[model samples]
Target: MLGRKLNDRYEIQALVGEGATAAVYRGLDLRLQRTVGIKLLLPYVDSTTRQRFQREAFSAAQLNHPNIMGIYDVGEEKDQNFLIVEYVEGEPLYSFIPSPPQVVAEYGRQICLALDYAHQKNVIHRDIKPANIHITPSGQVKIMDFGLAITPDSKRLTAMGRIIGTPAYLSPEQAQGLKLDYRTDLYSLGIVLYELATGVLPFDADDIGVLLLQQVKKTPKPPSELAPEIPPALEAVILKALEKEPQNRFTTAGEMAAALQIVLDGGADTRTTIQPAAAEPESAPLSAPAEAPHTGPIRVVLADDHRILRTSLAMFLDVNDDINVVGEADNGDQALEVVRDQQPDVLLLDLNMPGLGGLDILPQLRSNWPDVKVLVLTGRDEDVYIMRALRAGAHGYVLKTIGEDALVQAVRDVAQGNLVLGHGVAERVVQGFVGRAEVTSNVLTTLEHAILTGIAAGQTNDEIAQRLKLDPQIVGEELIELLDRMGTASRTEAALIALRRGWVALEDLHNIS
Candidate 1:
């Protein structure tokens, strides 16, 4: 299903993950020309389950807080139900456990703001554990997975007497299977804060039965007792939220967020703005840097999963007097931040980076920074992939095997608004131009024509060179130059022009007489 198009608008690119309820995909919205996350509910789910899923999705769609994952659309097509959501490029909060008090407060404040907004709308995120929260590289907290969210008017969708929510973060009322309200979320937030500051859950037991009992009956140690670095006022907020009675907890998420804000501001109400989670300059605010002033060099950002490749490329490009390597990234999300912040003249992107792939970010690059040319530097050789990148606004497609000279020239060409393609990629592009009836004559010189015929005949440059009694390097250089003269982007496109004009055919490749 990697290449399947759903509902004829959302094109599925790759499966991001799968769960018991649904399979999530990284997809493209053809109508909007944007990347989105598509969650496809399992077809076998009962009607009640589907209704509940829709209810939760539709309910969450109303929320517009920065910390909440935005829902875009939901629909069913030919028996397949799906929800299109904002594709957040981040890691689950659980991945960042054992965080420092300041960092916890920074993230916790965002979560509280989200909860405040959600609860004000009469929505209670029943599952408020670490796994339900995502932390962006920019340090923003986005709450996700509202599948079990309960509204004030929600009807029971579970078996009677059975509890829902993770036992580790469950409020005492939730553990008792009693009625729930907004205060229950604050209790869970306290558990999350406790875990964040102390690196351990407030109550822990291996047995589910024991865990639930502990959540209901046990008193938790103060967070300061374990972490010692936690300030007294912040610890008081945690203790208040951990109270067994709902009335004893903070009345609203806003109050709790205010308390954390005070701790972050050194016990003052300065309300110092929190910086985004992305790596920052030493002793500088994240927003302090505007676009780096152009200093007479073509700036470039490298986005690839391979560190060795990025380092080698950076080293090679650094020597070029005309080019400067401004930033490097290992994932698509980081790539976006780097490119946005640096505003480089060229973005050397790979196709399959983590979070967001090369293709997924092309539309964004086109929309947000159209002046910054995108040159896909990837190992993908398929014509389909190349066409997709080019159509999605990539200015160039170069393979990893590209020589330093060609790559450097491609960067310079793309920065000047010219399309560039490596030799092998050029051939694929030509092949894709097959079956067109319109013909142009004399696009190739006599020697270049012979070389194209030999290439169609499955002859390598060396083989063709020996047959033509010419130097292989000369043959290769002529082929590359011929592609430029013919105004074709790739070798395949050049080859297809020959094929479409009846200059070559599949039978010619092996028709030795």
Candidate 2:
């Protein structure tokens, strides 16, 4: 369609891009003499497809935010329908990723504001990945492709089992085919920000099934491990938005924007690690750094292969006066050695160590150092691993994606002989025991998925009650019954089981708080 005139106004110059449903072109507004992007619904689509195509124009037209791509006109000529939008002069946001995290944060805040405006107008951008966002030369963010947008009042066009967004950036709810809202967009944007800071998507793999499952159950490593300079406050905001459950995420794009502003304003308290204890006057070497004093605080050890991760966690943990990181080891052999030497009260262990894997060493540790409460803290959140860890005598299992506060609590809880399960880990264990067919059958019921999702998110009966507009007492009793039926010991385990069976999704596990 190059050089072709449309509606006697837009003169197509060159093809910009082509997707499964439409093609974009650089065009000139004949009357106004300005550049524009003309997105045309490709020929051969049925009437329903054409209607959906026109819906994009209608959806974008209602949104008049600066960061949103502007829709100038929706027209048809010679049976070809098209949308005329403002031409952005730069590449997609993905091209500029691995950028300075602060820059990404600034851009993220703008994207949030734009989303807030659209969401308030009742528009949900079902597709909100990096490719759908454009970054102009002036560094302005322009959200594009409202093609997949669905208004709250609009009829549903997609089939029940069909997923409509990119898998890597998909929220757990989206992957699970649950109803969605503005938080879905925020979760995707969180992925974009994570990639920007860490130079990789949080959940990625060659297989779509693997990617989707990972999004539903697995948690990514902390960004600081990839980019050591990244501030904890910034990582916290990004991780919070990425929560599997929508309620666990920032309530609104505006709230997310404000949170980013705080990070930018240098409000994240990240002081980790205490000065080593002062040496005795006779034992002073005068050349070495001071060591942390052994003052009867909860003695702890960190075991992970990543140096930056160890340092970051140690620093974060050291900030608590009651917790002291007595030793750190990168591999399982080193971990065993350190644990044997220090005899720390608690051990934070990773599964995929080089010399000896966490699984390989767990039985040995249980047999030998039975007194030390081992808490599995790793990026792996699979049911098999979680169950294995528990069976091997681990006191707790926590994912790397867990919040700092949760990490602290897990250590203390496990040290006191209380079993602690990370946000997604418990749900997976629950699913394994319940079996898949039963879980799927339950999710097929209306709003049953919502209840299950609430559980997976670790919500209390009253919280789920308020969210679904049901009676708190009834919700509580029903959950108790579910536990009995599922043969789980507690609500948390039931939720985790539902998660493992894929009846409950990680996105629903809003463990951010």
lDDT of 1 by residue, 1-513 (tens): 788888889998976665434677888999999988888876644554677688768778879888898888898887988988888876667666777677788888889999999999889888788867876666778888777788867776652122455667888787666788899999999999899889889998643444565677678998988999888877888888899999988889999999888878884332243343344322110001122322356899999999998999999988887789999999889999999899999999998787788888889999999889898999877544665677677877888887776577677656755456666654454334321112356444456668888866667889888987654655786677566666875767777877888777667666631
Residue range with the least summed lDDT across 10 consecutive positions in model 1: 282-291
- Top-scoring candidate (lDDT): 1
TM-score of 2: 0.53
Per-model TM-score versus the true fold: 0.52, 0.53
Query: Highest TM-score, which number?
Result: 2
lDDT per residue, candidate 2, 122-234, as tens digits?
99998887667766656677888787799866775641122455667888877666677778899999998999888888998643445566777777788899999888888
Each prediction's whole-model lDDT (CA):
0.75, 0.73
